[model samples]
Structures are given as C-alpha cells and as structure tokens.
Target chain A: MAILKTENLNYVYSQGTPFEKTAVRNVNLEIEKGEFVGIIGHTGSGKSTLIQHFNGLLRPSSGKIYLDGKDIWADKSQIRQVRFRVGLVFQYPEYQIFEETVYRDIAFGPKNMGLSEQETDRRVRATAQRVGIPESMLEKSPFELSGGEKRRVAIAGVMAMEPEVLILDEPTAGLDPKGRELILNQIKEYHKTMGCTVLLVSHSMEDVARYASRLLVMNRAEVFCFDSTAEVFKRSAEIEKIGLSVPQITRVFNILREKGIDIADDVYTVKYAKEKILEYLKSGGKLQ
Target chain B: MIKDITLGQYFPGNSVVHRMDARFKLVITMLFIVMLFIGSNTISLEVGFVFTAMAYLCSSIPVKLIAKSLKPILPILAFTTILNLFMITSGMPLFQWKFIAITDEAVETSVFMIVRILLLIAGTSLLTYTTSPVALTDAIERLLSPLKRFKLPVSELAMMMTIALRFIPTLIEETDKIMSAQKARGADMDGGKIKDKVKAVIPIIIPLFVSAVRRAGELATAMECRCYRGGEGRTRMRQLKSGAADYVSLGITIFFLAAVIFINAID
Candidate 1:
C-alpha cells in the first residue's frame, strides 16, 4: 500500500506580495511502504519544498496529501501525530540538537510523544546503539561531540520516534567520504531492520544509485521521471540536459558506448563498471 | 512561518529619493522627526503632514509599501492610543465610570498621538525604503567621521551595524529552519498551555543561540582573514558626496523647520 501520496501539490512563497514565487507546482507522487526512494534535483528544484509537504512542515496552497489513503490534514488535532509517523531529518540536522546530553537529545522526540520514562530511555538507548553512538558518549554533551558524532545523535533523535516513513534531506552533506558511507549504510540498515519506508534526498547521483530501490527525478519544480533505478538511468541524456549528471561510472560507460564499445548503459556504480570493463577486455575488444 | 517579516527591508528604485545623498537623506529624516515633535497646534501639525506627504510623493514609493511598513507597529500604536485615552484629562467627559474617564481631550490627544506616531514611522521608513542598507551604513560612517578625532571607533560601529542588518534576515531564516527541524521531531510549538508554550521555545532558542554564536565566530575569522582592521585610515568603495539635489533637499528641510518654529512661536 502507498504509505504517503500527494495529488497535484502546489506551494507559493510570499503569496500575495510583489516578490511572490511559485516554489513547487503540480507535484504528484506516491511512496509505497518499505520502499527506499531517492529524490534528486539541482538546487532550487523544489526538492526541499516537496519533502516539507511529506511531514506537513509546509501546507500546499492547493491539493491534498494523503497518508495511508486518508488525508493527513483531515483532523487539525492530529497534525502533530502525523509528524511522528513521518519523521523528516532535515539537512544539517546537527543544528537542531540542543539537549545537554546525547541521551537526553535522543529521548526528546519520544518524550514529546508522551511515552513513559522507561520506554523513552529504552528507545533512546536502542536508537543510539542502532546509529553506532558509543554508550559512554551518550552521557556527554551534544555540543562536545565531533561534527559527525553530533549528526548521528541528531538522526538518532528522530529515529527514536520509530516513524513508519523516514525522510532524510541530504543526510550525508558536508561529511567526509567515510562518514558519508557510514551514515548511508546506517540508514539502509535501519530501513532493512525496521522494514519502514525511506526517502533519501541527495545531490550525488552515485549515492542514490547505490542505495535507493526507486528513484524520483525532479527538475525545475516538477517530477522529471519516477521509476526503478535501472529504468531511470536509461534516460541519462534528459537528466544531463537539466544541469544534473548521472553517476560518474554511468558517465564512463556512456563514453564507452559512444565509442561503439559493447558495454551496458545502466552500469551506475564502480563495482559494476569494473565487471563490465573486465568482460569487454577479455572479449577481444579493440581500443578505439 | 517566520519568513514574513519585512523589518529593515530595503526596496530598490531610481527615483529622486533614491538618488539623494544618503547623508543628506539621513539629516532630512532627523529634521522631519524633529518637526513632528515641534508641532503644538493644528496649523503646525498640518504643515508637518503636508511636508511628510510631499516627501513620500517625491520618493515615488508606493503608498502600499509605507502601509506595509507599519504592520509590525500596529499593536504598539493601538496600545499607546488606548493608554493615552485613559491618561489625558481636559474638556467635556464622554464616559465617566469610577477611575476610568474618557474625555474629549483624551479622544483628541489619542487620535493626534496615533497620527503623529504613524507619520513618524512612515517618514523614517522612507529612508530605509529608498536607501539600501549598505549605502545607509556608509553614510552613517561618513557622517560620524568627525568623531574619529575624539578617539571614537565610528567606522567599526558602522561596520557592526552593517553586519547586524545584513544578518537579521539570515538569522530569521535559520530560526525558521531550526523550528521546522524540531517540529519534525514532534517538538510541539502549538497546542500548549502558556507554560507549555514558553517551555516549548527552549528547544528552539537553544539551537538558535548556538548557531548564531557559531556564525559570529565564523564571520569574525573570515573578517580577520580578509585583513579587516578598525577605522584607522580605511577607505570605502562607495564614497559619500553632496550634490545639487542634496543641497536642494537640505534647503527645503531647513525651510520646513523654520516654518515649524514660526508656527510654534505664534501658537
């Protein structure tokens, strides 16, 4: 079942003012349960605006957002409940970490949900462990932690809520390569272990290609395409036209294909590209 | 939701007001404010109103923009008007019940005070509306250049003001971002009692303060890297100059002040 869906969502900034702008328009999308979806777009492509709608951080000027085939906005009193069900980890999540201790920081969300002290502690500890935060560090101040550690604690704070649908906007931004891989892998592990729906918004095509089962391409405030990872990569030319490139490995394969080499166009990662190149070299392929 | 603030917003235009020297404009604004206070009767108030209207017209700024500028101060205006209505005592009483008596003089004073306050805001808003913040700060530094001989850091003070003005919108944006992030984590900003609402702001304020300090530290380092020393022997990219229009504007402002003084003396 589609856990979250939007029909023709539209948003305008400074609505009546002379500086008014239509940020997101006519955006239609659906996310099924237990599916890891990746959203990719250039800056100012309405990616943030669209994700903001998923958690009700922003209301559409027109149209509806449905969660579990019911309107999320049906009951004004239940809007806060909807936010817990759809946890959104915004970019630079570290800025939102305010608790004196990492443990208290992680417990903030669950406590807000009115969970019992024991239950909140259990969930906070479980989430901290899940995100690989050391037990000793949980008692330390969030401000005293390193940048990457602070980020993990912040993500764990939302994860402690155990939302049915998780949305992370650029979770790996400003991290070193190892930090990036660790964070992405932790998110993938969480999705797998919890069997929850995940949506990752990223600028790096390679990151999306490596993790997401489905890809939703947004260009200029509209969905350019939404399909399986392999299917979306097939339209690499159209994606490139909008000032976004495909995965680096996919670009190399496209170059090889242009030279009449018998390589698959859908090879997006380095590991897959390596296998394809080895096969081509062994098959008596001539260098052009 | 906090992005709707229009405080200190500068509107760009190419009218005579925009072209007037910033220092001259600042001086005129001060004179206009002084004139607002000098009025003692209807005649001087009328003169002040006409001059303010003429200044607004010459700026070519839309009337709606000036009205919008007053949006944030409406509550203050209402409160002051109400307080004046209760405090003033003179003339025929309209309502008398125990300690609270609304008199004709109270009514008159309230209306006049409200009008004076609104006109004060509108007239000063004209300076911000026409002059960009950068130009305004530059003009302030130049106007205060004489204080440099007294060992005052005029340029440094102006630079601090410039950075503060530049960052108001940015900090507001950061606050909005932090609030949304916390809201996503189920930090309930709404649907709370008075105590709960104030308590809920703790999460918001902590992060905001931390980020503001971080930004300040980063900005300080950046300034140091750019070799930004104090006002000593510093040169500006945009130099302040007084032109024919500036002289004309100053002359008109002086004439208006003279008229206000004459009306005050006669009244």
Candidate 2:
C-alpha cells in the first residue's frame, strides 16, 4: 500500500484577507513504502506547504490526505496518532531544540508518545547513535554543541519517535561541505537499516540526483513532475525551463551530447558520468 | 492563531491624511485627545464629535478595521458604562435599588463617556492607519532631536522602537511555525485541561524564545557588519521635511481645539 497519498489538495494561505494567497493547489501525490522520494522546488514554490500536510501540521483547504489508505483527518480525535506515524523534520530544525540536555531533547517526542521511561531512554540512545551523535555528548547541553551536532540532535529527536515515514525539509541547509556529506551519509544509513520511506526536500539538484529513487518536482505551487529519477531527468529541458538549475553534471553531459559526442543522456550524478565516460572511451567513441 | 492582531498596523493609502507629515499627525492626535477631555458638556462634546467625524471622512480607512480594534476592549467599555450608571446619584433617579441607582444624569454621563472614549480612539487610530511605522519613527527622532542637547539618546531610542515594531510580525510568524512543529510531534495543544494546555504551550514557547534570541544575535551582528556605531553622525536616505500639507493639518486641528474650547466656555 502507498504509505502516503494526497488527492486534489489545495491550500489557501491567510484566507479572507488582503494578503490571501493560494500556496498550493490540485496536488496529487503518492509515496510507496520504503521509497526515497526527493522533493525539489524553488523558494516559495509551495514545497514546504505541501509536505506540512502529510503530518497534519496543516489542514488542506479542499482535499484528502490518506496515510496507509486511511484518511489522516477522518477522525480528528486521533490525528496525533497520524503525526506519530508520519514524522516531519522542519527546515533548520535545530531551532526547535530546547531541552537542557541532548538526551532529554531527543526523548521529548517519545515522552509525548507516552512511552515508559525505560522505553523512552532506549529509543533516545539508539536514535542518537543512529544519527552519529556520540553517547558522551548526550548529557551535554544542545546549545553547547556545534551547529551540525545540534542539528543531529534535533533530527534524532524526531527519529526517536520512530515514525514509519520520515520527511525532512532542507535538513542539510547551511552546513559546510564535510558536514553536509556527514549528515547525508548518516541519513542514508538510517534509511537503509530502518527500511522506512523518506522524503528529502532540498534545493541542491546534485544532492537530490545522488540519493532519491523517485523525484517529485514542484513549480509555482503545482506538482510539475512525479516519476523515477531516470525518467524525470529524461525531461531535463522541461525541468530547466521552470528555472530550476539541473545538476552541473547533467548540464556538462548535455553540452557533450550537443557537440555530437554520442553519450547517454541520463547522466545526473558524477559517479554515473565518470563510468559512462570511461565506458565510452573503451568502446572507441571519440570526441567530435 | 496570533495573526488577528491589527494594532499599530499601517494601512497604505494616498489620501490627504496619509500624505500629511507624520510629525504633524502625531501632534494633532495628541491635541485632539486634550480637546476631547476639555469638552465636558453636551454642546462641547457635540463639537468634538463633529470634528472627529470630519477627520475620519478625510482618512478614507474602512470603519470595519476600527471595529475590529475595538473588539478587544469591549469588556472595558461595558464595565465603564455599568459603573457610571449606578455610581452617580446626583440627578433625579429613574430606577432605584437599595444602594445602586440609575439616574437621568447617570445615563447621560455614560453616553457622553462612551462617545468621548470611542472618538478618542478613532482619532488616534486614524494617525496610525495613515502613517507607516518607519515614517512615524523618523518623525519622532526629528521631533526629539532637541533633547540631544541634554545628552538624551533620542535617535537611538527611536531606532530601537522602530526595530521592535519591525520584528513583531516576524516573531509572531516564528511562534506560529514553532507551534506547528511541536504539534507535529504529537504535542496535544488543543482539547485538554487547563494544566495540560499550559504544558503543551511550554514546548512552543521555549522554541520560540530560543529562535527569537538567535535572531536578535544575528541582527546585531549584521548591523555591526554594516558599521553601525551610533546615530550622532548618521545620515538618512529619506529626510523628514515639513511642507504646506503639514501646516494645513496643524491649522485644522488647532481650529478644532479652539472651536471645542469656545463651545465649552459658552456652556
């Protein structure tokens, strides 16, 4: 079954005011279990608004969001149960960390879930370790940690809830190069070991190209494209037309193909580009 | 849920009231309040009300927004009315209870008080609706510039007020976002006991406070990067200069005051 689904979704912000705006409209999407869905959009393209609905942080103006084939808002009394099943890690989530210690901070979600003390402790430690936070640092204040470490604690807070579907909005924003790679690799490991669906909202096309199996592209509050990574990249021209910067490697390959180099067109990642170039040279395909 | 606040909000327009200098508008609003209090009798209050109505007609702002602003103060208005209706016993009694009584003079006094209070708020809200906060602050800094002779930090105080006003909406937006983030973590923010409601608010408030402090630090650093030292030698991009519009507004408001005072003296 699809882990999450939204049909005919519409959201009007600041309704009945002069600043009223339709942030999202007619958004139809589905995420299967264990699928790594990448969300890509320009700023103010409604990517944030669309994902907020998955966890019931926002109610759609007109539509339905079904989690595991059950409407999330069907019974308002049990909506918090839906929030537990679908975790949403907001952008720059470190700002949400407020507990005195990292351990207590990570346990906040589990405690809210009414877990026993021992169970909450177990989940907090396990999640902290899974997110690459050192066990010794768990007793220290989150404010005392570096920016990247604090972000890990914030992520672990949500991970401790152990939601079946994890959604991160710009989790890697404002991090240095090495820090970015470290967090992304840890998240990749977590996804593999937990076998849960993940939705990573990011601005970097290269990052999305490297990890996501399926891609969801938004433009001007509409779902422009929703397909596999390979299939979406096939319409690279259309993606670029919406003013999204396709990955640098994809642009480089596009230039090569234009000059009669006769290389395959689905080169989005640097690793794939390197393999294809070496294979082309081995197969006697010469530069024009 | 905090977005309903319309206090101190500036409505954009190009009417004569909006075009008047912010300094003149502030002075006129102050003088108008003094005039309203000076008009103690019915005839003087009638003059004050007519002048305020004329100002409102020139402002072009919708009365619906004014009513929204009054909504939060309805309890106070009602309480004032009740206190005046029973507390005063000088005139002939219309209805008498053991100690509480409603007299003709008391009823008239309540109506007069309510009308004066409503007109006072309307006149002041008109000034805020016409002038943007930035313009108002700039005017204030200029108006208070003479205080610098006594070593008072007038410009700095005005700048602080302006910055504070500028961030009210930002802080409110941050609060809304933090509330949603905590609620997504299964924090029961609604349909709970009083203590439970307070407990749910802790998660939201702590994060909002942290973010606000962080933003303040960032803003200070940004200002320092731009080499902001003090307002002593600082120049502005837009200078506040008085013109014919300013003088005309001053004259009109003074005329309003003179007319109210004359009516009160005759009464």
Q: Hey, what RMSD does candidate 1 come out at?
A: 1.8
- Index of the highest-lDDT prediction: 1
Candidate 1: TM of chain A?
0.96
Least well predicted 10-residue stretch by lDDT in candidate 2 chain A:
A181-190
Q: Using TM-score, give the best candidate's number.
A: 1
lDDT of 2: 0.89
Model 2: residues with Cα > 4 Å off, grouped in runs: B86-105
Judged by whole-model lDDT over C-alpha atoms, candidate 1 comes out at: 0.91
DockQ metric, candidate 1: 0.86
Candidate 1 regions exceeding 4 Å error are A274-288, B94-101
Q: What interface RMSD do all candidates show, one decimal each? A: 0.6, 0.9
Query: TM-score for each prediction?
Result: 0.96, 0.94
